[model samples]
Target: MKPFPVATALTIAGSDSGGGAGIQADLRTFSFHRVHGTSAVTAITAQNTRGVTRVDLLPPESVTAQVDAVASDMRVDAVKVGMLAQRPLIEAVADQLARVSLGPIVVDPVMVSRAGSQLIDNEAVEALRSRMLPLAAILTPNRHEAKLLAGMDIQTLEDMREAARRIHALGSRVVLVKGGGMPGALRGTDVWFDGTRMETLSVAPVDTPNTHGTGCTLSAAIAARLALGAPPLEAVRLAKEYVTSALRYPLAVGHGNGPIGHFFPLIHD
Candidate 1:
């Protein structure tokens, strides 16, 4: 008998040729969750596990066309958006997603790379907040991005809570302030703040240097769980577990940073 059609997830993001982050990581995370994955490339990055050397933003029309094509044919249950390079592109993606009525959107506010290179421009950050956050089901911003969005320094757990509240007020129904960037912490803590309540999800940081794709993997896994009919909190829980495992079995590639083992279980398979 033919297998049943898996729930589909669409990733609107950049292409990371390194196979560690961006569209590559998104697709791998979806596959690991047993979901069908589709993509609309918004930008192309000359990047590896080491760093992003260059970025080329795809034309806004081309980006819109890809999203339209995928939405027209596929039953996209969830979307993970990342690495929109410019203001016009951000606005275009927001517009296209609105037109298609894409549900269960997980916005990973990817601003900088693991190697400390700025990914999104200054103006695009504002555009992202105004154009995209309102439509997102959940906004996943790392501590630094959270600070940028909340317009203040988040130096403590209390600050994280306040930042989450402020970011939620910006229009996202849920805000996940990722705490991996916080100082004096080996255990990564993610604070999930829905309108009604706040929950802290903590995991001991995997002792590995190969963490090139953690954010993209986490956000995409959440999208996959959402596609599989999991609630927001539950989705985040599962995604965190997956990311921790991935980090534990990171691929020992590249001279600088290295990619996480997305198919870490494939050795058994």
Candidate 2:
């Protein structure tokens, strides 16, 4: 007998050897959401919980080829994009996206690492903002990334609102400025805007140092929800809830910062 049907979500991102971020985290989140996961790796990183030590980018053609091979055979219901490390990769991914009409693309603009290190160059940032942002159905940028894209520091809630508005003007159907990195009580607050109405999603903060893949996990969950036929607002809400629950029980494996419990439902204490 044929297997039962399930929604499929594709991730176009870098590979994380540590299984905590990038494509690894995205695919893991997709599994948790019960969506069939597919991926096109743009770069590979020698990284673990400690940090990224080295990075190797695949050729632009190779990236596009992976996307092509998947699109030619499989039915991709939704897509999540992350960590295009350079301008060429950004342009290539943007070109591929423009060529095919994929379902809700969640752009998780992976510019800066959680530890405040700039992962991509200035030119790549411009490329992402100009080329990739325009194609995003939902653009998920944390405080630092929103600042970079919107050209302002995001410290207060008002800053997040303004940043979301500025990013929305860049052509995304929706913009979510995550305030997880905000100081004190503002943490875990996210501002969502879609040109006209703006709202804040406030969740009680999960205090854990093992939040390495939070960003990737959130975007992937959103894509999975989109694949499962949720509207944009509902998808974001579900994704936020998933991330918060995962953060409640983090995995205690690595030496440094660890991963959230993507399998929390199965292994919670």
Candidate 3:
């Protein structure tokens, strides 16, 4: 018999040797959603659970070549972009992605830290906001990132809504301002805005210290659902649900923060 049909998704991100985040987490999340995963790694990080020791970025040409190799051979049903840490890499990936035909592109804006620190340079931030966000089907930015992008402080739920609106104006088809870093009872409440429809996506916060890869995992799950032909809103909803459940089954590995249970269904604990 012929091989079974399968949906394929591509992750254009960095590698986490720790296996908690970056390309490793993305592929795991894809597999959990039953989507075949492909990758074009932008950086290699020498790190484990505790922290990153070093990072080496792949040449922009090499990154684009990997993308070309995949696109020429197979149909990429969806694309998840994460952690393009500089201007050149950000522009290159955006150019390469535009040249290829892919499904919903989930842009995980990883430019700001939870502590309100700017993780990327101003030029890189501008490049991502200009090149990547415009191509994004869904742009996922956490509290601090939304603060940077929208040029406003996010201290309340309404602030999140405003941030989402501002980001949506920047051309992303949809903007999801993640509230995981928000204060008080609003922590797990996510604000979604798509120019027209706006709503808050909320779930009871999962109480787990092993929340490593949460951002990457959630975006990857969204891309996985997109690969499987789910509508944008439905994909985000499903991904959120998946992340919440996986957090409940957190893995107790690593010396520091560990990964959430990607294959939660298989764990018999």
| Candidate 1 per-residue lDDT over residues 83-201, each given as its tens digit | 88789989988888887876599999878653345667889988998999998899999887888889898888889999999999999999999988777772498899998799888
Residue pairs whose backbone atoms clash in candidate 1: none
Every candidate's lDDT: 0.88, 0.92, 0.93
lDDT of 3 by residue, 171-219 (tens): 9999999999988899899999989999889999988888889999999
Residue 109 CA error for candidate 1 (Å)? 1.1
User: What is the Cα-based TM-score of model 3?
Assistant: 0.98
Model 3: colliding residue pairs: none
Ranking by lDDT: 3, 2, 1
- Where does model 2 exceed 4 Å of error? none
Where does the lowest 10-residue lDDT sum fall in candidate 2? 112-121
- Which prediction has more favorable TM-score, 1 or 3? 3
Candidate 2: tens digits of C-alpha lDDT, residues 148-249: 889998879999999999999999999999988898888999999999889999999988999999999999999999999999999999999999999998
TM-score of each: 0.95, 0.98, 0.98
Off by over 4 Å in 1: 1-3, 114-117
